[model samples]
Target: MTVALMWEARAVAGRGEELLAWARDQGLSVRPLRRETFRAPGDRVLVITWWDAAYDAELPELPEPEGELVTRPVHRWRFESVEQGA
Candidate 1:
């Protein structure tokens, strides 16, 4: 099964773009099979990375952005793929 890491954060007031840009430049120690970033309505950013490992496997993750750029701490989640379609 393939595992995926989902990270999310909200910018402080009007720092959404800056936060997104910062995230874009960050790199993970383990390259992902696929990665994507998204913007939500309320200055929220979501990043998803697909990796070729089990959900419990150890993996490198993007570091937290500088505290000043975010309203709160980043949230992270992991999941194992049970179905996929192309």
Candidate 2:
């Protein structure tokens, strides 16, 4: 069964595009909910991404990202056993 993993990235700076692209290239199909800019004293932006099992991989030790990430938000939830197609 496929599952959906939802990530919430708040106040992210730099490397957003890179991460998104990398995940896709690795076979994770993501549906971006929103990438908005705001001014609230610190939390400036929010990025929500939904990814599923198509991107599954064997966990491995990897090096640091080619670019640095200023801020990051943790993934919030995992909805399991998702059904695909009609």
Candidate 1 lDDT: 0.89
Lowest-scoring 10 consecutive residues by lDDT in candidate 2?
A: 57-66
Instruction: Report the C-alpha displacement of residue 82, candidate 1, in angstroms.
Output: 0.7
Best model number under TM-score? 1
Candidate 1 regions exceeding 4 Å error are: none
List pairs with backbone clashes in candidate 2.
Answer: none
- TM-score for each predicted model, relative to the true structure: 0.93, 0.31
Q: Model 2: per-residue lDDT, tens digit, 1-86?
A: 34444444333455556454443343223333322222333433222333334446322211223444426434344455546577
| Full-model lDDT for every candidate | 0.89, 0.38
**In candidate 1, how many Å is residue 53 off?**
0.4
Off by over 4 Å in 2: 10-12, 28-67, 80-86
